[model samples]
Target chain A: MSKTPLPDDKAMLDDIAAIVEKTGCERKNLIPVLQNIQDRFLYLSEDAIKILSGHFGLSSCEIYGVATFYNQFRFNPPGKHQVKICLGTACHVKGGDIILENFERKLKIKTGHTTEDREFSIDKVACIGCCALAPAVVIDEKTHAHMTPTKIEGIFLGYEIEKEMKIREEKKRDDKDTPA
Target chain B: MMIIISVDDKEIQAEEGTSLLKVCLDNGIYIPNLCYMEGMETPPSSCRLCFVDIDGEKNPVPSCSVKVREGMKVFTNTPRVRGLQWSAFELIMSNHRIDCGSCLSRKACPLIKISRHLKIRLKPFRVGHINSGNEDIVEDHPCLIYDITKCVRCGKCLHICEKIHGRLYLTFAGRGVDMGISFFGDSDDETIPCARCLACVKICPVSALLSYERYEHSPEGSSS
Candidate 1:
């Protein structure tokens, strides 16, 4: 069986150090430090957490405990695209849970897990502040309103085709750049 | 200084600035709570079980987060308060492993006691069970054994760990529904730094954390 690769600790530490510098490396700046690190890495890595613990004079457990108290922080690496299904009151009444289950089935990954190919990840958010557009699904910051289980396949296909076209265009650009 | 508050039409004197939940609990008044960590300055109020109706307030407020005030009128058994508490208790039990019949701590488990007090039957809710199949049991430590499935994320263990040890070796990892308490570092030989004070195990409310020896000697045939 192939072994899982370890994250580049040196690069991650550098990014964490930059965040700590920006956030002032204080115990009280824990949330901001975690937020900035997550913004840079899409999730809080073990190495980043260790660096924060050292900088803040807190144990790794302390940092991890505080981070887990909130729903915003993530520990695993996120995917290229984040798929968020709104589970707000309006959305729930409009069958948002069904839409979420369909996405989970289609992606073959549960909520809060990245796909094996790192193409997408799913999350059930409390709300996107758009109750008027009940049953909303947000993909990479783009919102799709009035979503249904049947519309999931079309959305997946659209992203797949878009990704294929982008790959082809990049290949063409590389060919033009190379010497004939 | 002492403050007077009326709870269920009974006038009670409590220490000023103390949490209403603490006053109610200390005075033999039952207000169900799962996340009220003792000596915590700011309560998380995540459990939503200690909700109480206050005079002039339209909605029931969480008693653990609110400090007592002089001459405040509080109602603990109002229909709205009971309804909200019951819903919160049911929500907490929804994801919990309800195998009390075979649990090692069946006699003294706080989850069982609190649920019994709240009159919450172990029935399934519409939210469904979160059978994630991620019940990883950690038995590396000679003294402690952590069962990930039974955890309710009360934060009591972490708080008491820091309170007693002045440093935390255990922590909650991950976020959202997948969050679970875990030990730091990868070394099996790290020799679980806990002082064996049993602070975390005693503070755990649920039977998630148990003494390894106690678990071994407990009744057999129980699912982990």
Candidate 2:
């Protein structure tokens, strides 16, 4: 059966419309659905907001305000390796600042910024709830505690060497495959 | 009926509609999660600590609520997921007080530990008022203290009070900057007739909620 071809933008709008429609136009569920979209789309694009507002019968600014209000939600595409330094009460008192500085100097990136390589992105967190050790940082999902500037450097070097070694191995294989 | 999914390169079998959070835990892939208290009827996605990346999805979604599908690929420790989780973690931290050395929930808290693991940074965003030490302290209940300064407003206390304790004794009263746990007048006793269930105590992601005897019980470990 021949199917009617809808434009890419319209199809995406339709999908978003369907999601909003499924929520029954309730304001309460707006955030959750937006979250789902953000989850699927990285950042909440203006197009998605327009589609959502149109579907929910709300203003685009209202959607933007709600989107910006929650920290879990974001409006921009983030960098590659997101580094989080714990600045929670316990962590803050326990030299969380030093750890954050270590990241800034080593990665050559400031908080809320992605590295030039786009390989690392850094951020500060309130608390991940492991106050036992205080002054902690999380790289991806691995929690490192009682961090020191020296240890942070060693940790980065370890990842760097591992990454470099992998690249080298790939290069060696490529050379072997070349026609002599 | 079952779908094959990969986590950090290892494949696991999961039911059609199983959540990615459950899948990781079931397969012994411990993805750090603070808000995922087991057996809660409601899925509280309040804490974004459990964010993870899926292959087709653009951004990382909370593993606690997102379902796993057939042939799905996921990465829990990706730079993207870690960055967003850290951002969310910072949002929670900016409102919290910085007195972990003296705080009651020093060792047992998971949020602090996870933040350490992720190397979470706190650049401080303006959120709620920091305790100035001049405002009248509100310790209505003898068993617990509601220090607004220490709270991240994770809603753990509010949810526990309503869900486990029945009546909503502790509502997050006021608007954004002024939000805090407030209770209607119970009696002259200055304490709600809470069952002392300790659900709030357990669910508190930070040291905001504290029990009176918690420190006394652990004399040696009560450094904070």
Candidate 3:
């Protein structure tokens, strides 16, 4: 995957401003405003919160408290691939903890943390409503059922291989365009 | 309008639509409460300590959230009410890392008072403690020390801060069982507003929020 440069402060402010223009600056519409921000940027940026605070006539702390009260928002910049391990009641019964530990060990990052390269982030869900699958691990958008420690390694390796292949394909196209 | 309500067989007269807990406490009937403050338009029923069984209602309701009504029959110390109050108290204490001797508010801690009144231990034997998995103390604020373990999520500090400064600097962070106050300011913040407004430190029921010097002058650290 190609690495995109971080959005500049001006661009981020403009995006937030556009969202505020549609949602207005009312205090009551904070959830919708935050949701829109979350959808635009996977996680709420500090600049976005500050811009929203100014637009809504609210203090930064006040907006921050609201954003945190609901667990929906995350302040960290999201990684490209999100690995969600379901630790639901059924999943837990069927060795979900082991599966989670395996992922954490393999990634060299604990749950709710992203790798330094911003490629993978691990998250544990209370439930994904797939109890029949028991121990389920969802990477990006696809769910893998009955995940074991060996299976988790294989899956992550596959992701890395796919990523490498995509990079190689992009390099080939670039070479063709430049006519070397 | 004034309304007469019977609380634990005592006839008490209070303003209608006011908090039942306030009415009972005003009339020398003590019902344990944490979040309720005088003159709050809406009481955040976060603490869940002031449970009173009303005659008509099937379940015990938090007295702080209940409005005083005319001819209302309320039982604060009934077996059912006591059971529910104790449960709530234990629930709050379950997450609370209780250490009385080291606490800054040891002399005036509400948890101690509630435990004495409710006959429940500070570290409850009934419910196993739920680890928050966060640091015991957060010293990130420029001028304050937040003890995450001691915080009961009572919202008293939040209320008082909102009243004094039009909003809270130490607002809630996280959600569900992991929820607690999050001081949004950086440790290196030059313009620390909380230094002037120690309202949160003064208002906290469990002494979760304290001034920077509170540790040095803590009961164990200094002579009183």
Candidate 4:
């Protein structure tokens, strides 16, 4: 536990408070409230849920039940990059499971889990509605079609390089802003 | 208005739009199910055991979610339906703990009855079990005991809570493979106690939810 408060924690709380105010704290607004919270936070944190429960006068259990029933909601904080492997009917027939297994092995993390460094997280989606591109994987909103086990290593290597470049660029900008 | 539907070649007169599952059970036709509550408007259709082949449909459908129609033909014992039901049963039981010898709800457990009806033996260690991380029996509440390892995620308890209390205290937490029921709020608070209705326990298809007192004095405890 760091003594310094996270800069974003207050902003996140303000956003949550605004959403709750807009939703009017009704029992029926639970789903939409969750959707909004997830949209803001990238996932539902325990803190956010506890706040929502307080506003709605519902127990944590009730809120959790609704969240678990649906496949869309995520509890853990999302990685910087999201990797979704389509496991739809078309993809499944075209060896999507093998591709997914390959990703899991390479990332050293199971589906729905972020890497230890929090760089990437993987999820198995029912479909992206792109059946033509069987065995598809979407990384940070970019679709990679006709994926295979061999292609996964190269794809991850590309992301790693991209991350390094971004970090270098950010460091250069920070140095330029500092006094001589 | 009454409409006639043929279930297993026996023509039964049922009301229009009534659930085929309700009709079958009313007529002494057993279709195994775990998620269908009597008054629930929108059925969860989670349990795939009630699969039945209707005339003109290529694949079997869950009978609980299907409404009976006039001149409709339903085949309850078709090969495809049995195959789907068996696979669903096996999949559900794969994650379930099968320690019936020491379990409290042995005599009344619906999973046991359904398995026996399907003639499938309980093979505990055949498939890998889901580690829900809720293996410890929750004894926080004096009346209710929850052993999440035995839970089937049937949604029965959640629905019953809503029906009885107008709001649910128990709810599902997590998603996909990690999903399980969790109690909300402080369990020690006496104002919102579990109602002690036992509706959830009575409705549980497995022994996941048990009465703390009954569990202590269960059949297995006598010899021990």
Candidate 5:
């Protein structure tokens, strides 16, 4: 629930402990336990690994190893908006690299890093299997097919409007709650 | 009872359920192998160098995983087997640093031995070398100087650690091209003392894992 993954988070620790209890502690459950943690926190936190190591009676390094072995595992908390640009053969030929550079330049963050505001994160995937949509960019799991550098500005505008609406709705609800 | 198996048209007698790779090796047959050790119930099968063609199988299978059966006909050097092995070896070589002259295990290097046996060049000709991320080899571990560039992703070091310590202290982290390994000197409570056993250094085929003390004194260490 917390964006910053502190190992001392009591609520997160309890949830992780509950996950271990529900999943059972056989070595076979290692992946499932990790998956559950990742599902809950959107990433594999260091504290989660330590909890697993303590519960499973295994070393933390070994737990970390299994977690890192799979591509599905994420060690960093994802930003609010995750951008995955495809760099497969078709996409690469269609200026996927240029699109990635545009995103990095706009966000002021390098690839594989979250923006300082934690609003956006950039990642380059081998392929999204949408070769027909060459230079595909997926933001927040919504695939934007045939993306261009100029197109990124329009997409950001859309997200900004969405964020603005959500904030306004939250403010209105807060105002109503205060009985004014 | 000894079971009879025909390998390369030569009949060999071996115990039932013996690993085909071990059976072949025991009877003076050589198979280019790595990541295999005696008494291992399940070999890592990661190196994938020990491939053999058995009759009735459409594709070449790793010999280390195959158990010798009665009346089984096996071919060790068929074009298919060699082709698969060559590609696998080449892939491994692509990841390898191949600077054998500067390597500590030059004398006992298994890569050189495999290359000679396979009649393939140590340098990969098919698949170009992959840059293994970091060019700088910096290790903070007290006991070992782990050169990431030379590691072949073999689980020998991890296996040996598990066998020796009754738990996996060393582990291969990450997967695919970015995978790396780690070693813990002790457990959380510091109950188990590793004491620089150096088993990993000895077990490594290409000397990816080296003793820090030895590495410090070596010409390679002084220069680095």
Candidate 6:
């Protein structure tokens, strides 16, 4: 992928304007409209939120408050692979704590934290409802249930495979550029 | 135009262009689902539990999000699909609070009802440092209570606030593990419109959001 950023603010703002019109600019309709916009754009940009606030005749804080109140709205960029650990009742009772601890130690990030490489973001979720298989964790939407601290290394290695391959490819390019 | 769609080994004809989810429900072909309210467009495909395998796709896609195309082969219930769905279900249930006995939507919550119907007999995972307790629940103001522990990040609450209120108030603050709802501009009572619209409460599939003065236990609910 090129180092260039995706799109400019103007394009993003225009896209938000389209959502505002389609949502009918009703007071109650703001959240869905924003959600739709966010679905298109990974996160809600400040410009988009400002446009929505102006169209809805609400303050930016009001707009931002609702956006920040739900788990689906993302203010920051997401990782390539998202890892979520269930910490609900059954899982918690069955050593879900140990699993989460393992992830934190291995990823060097706690729940609600993302690795600097942007490869992974680890989160703690409530019940995924697979209680019979307590202490489960989901990586990139693939669930790994009944996990033990021992199994975490394997899981991390699975993700690390892709990460390391990418690093090696980049290093090869740099080596070719060295002076003779 | 009527089109035929296959669920497992059975083939059924349905009106053209209806959502696979609606067709399945009409035919009594229960393709597992959550975050999809029959009447609401929140399509809330956000939950990812409605995923079903179509013939050629690499990954199982959410049935609720895709429209049924002609001659499309759909696999509703399968060993692999069930496992994937079950895994997703476990993820949501683990992160969600289990005080359903006292929740208002305990009887009506889709997640709870669907789990019983699926006869999900296993508890594969559990919670860690993020304790599930009353103290962890957020009673931030008079209008609502946000129990972060019970949330599934379905975007249903986000839709309700934006769709009905014309104001983008609260939203998911971070990505991945740090992903949870947060307040904007000091999420305080004075700042909140306190509309008490109950959109967030009504849309939540779990007990993440609740009314301020709810009392009494939840009534009997459906396992269907």
Chain A, model 4: TM: 0.80
DockQ per model, Cα: 0.36, 0.01, 0.43, 0.35, 0.42, 0.15
Which residue segments of model 6 deviate by more than 4 Å? A1-180, B38-44, B126-135, B186-193, B215-224
* Candidate 4: share of reference interface contacts reproduced: 0.67
| Candidate that scores best on TM-score | 3
What TM-score against the true fold does each predicted structure earn? 0.65, 0.48, 0.83, 0.64, 0.77, 0.52
Q: DockQ for model 5?
A: 0.42
User: lDDT (0-100) at residue A28 of candidate 6?
Assistant: 83
Computed on alpha carbons, the lDDT of every model, listed in order, comes to: 0.80, 0.71, 0.82, 0.81, 0.82, 0.72
What digit string (tens of lDDT, one per residue) describes model 4 on residues B154-175?
9999899888888777777766
Question: The CA-based lDDT of model 4 is what?
Answer: 0.81
Is model 5 an incorrect, acceptable, medium or high docking prediction? Answer: acceptable
Q: Give the candidates in order of TM-score, highest first.
A: 3, 5, 1, 4, 6, 2
Candidate scoring better on DockQ of 2 and 5:
5
Could you give the fnat of all candidates in order? 0.61, 0.00, 0.56, 0.67, 0.69, 0.31
1 or 2, which is superior by TM-score? 1
- What DockQ number belongs to candidate 6? 0.15
lDDT by residue for model 2 over B114-224, one digit each (tens)? Answer: 667777544344343344322233466556656677776677676666666555555554446556665423322433555356678667876666666663454423544
Clashes of 4: 2
Per-residue C-alpha lDDT of model 1 across residues B1-224, encoded as one tens digit per residue: 98789999998999999999999999999888888976779998988888999998889999999999999999988889888877877777766877776677777676767667767675546556775445457775556788777787888887888778788778877666667777754224444555357778877777788876667765632434
Give the per-residue lDDT of model 3 (tens digit) for B1-224.
98798987888889999888888888999889888898888888877788889999999888887888899999988898888888898898899887776777777888889999998888878888988767677877778888888888888887887788776577787778778788763334555577777888888878888887876688743653
Give the per-residue lDDT of model 3 (tens digit) for A96-178.
98998898898898777888898989888889999999899888999999898899878978988999999999999999999
The lowest-lDDT stretch of 10 consecutive residues in candidate 1 chain B is B186-195
Docking class of 6: incorrect
Give the better candidate number (5 or 6) by DockQ: 5
Candidate 3 pairs with clashing backbones: none
Could you give candidate 6's per-residue lDDT for residues B43-92 as a string of tens digits?
A: 86877688788899887888998888887898866667777788777777
Q: What value of lDDT does candidate 6 attain over all alpha carbons?
A: 0.72
Which runs in model 2 stand beyond 4 Å of their true positions? A1-180, B121-137, B187-192, B215-224
Give lDDT for model 3.
Answer: 0.82
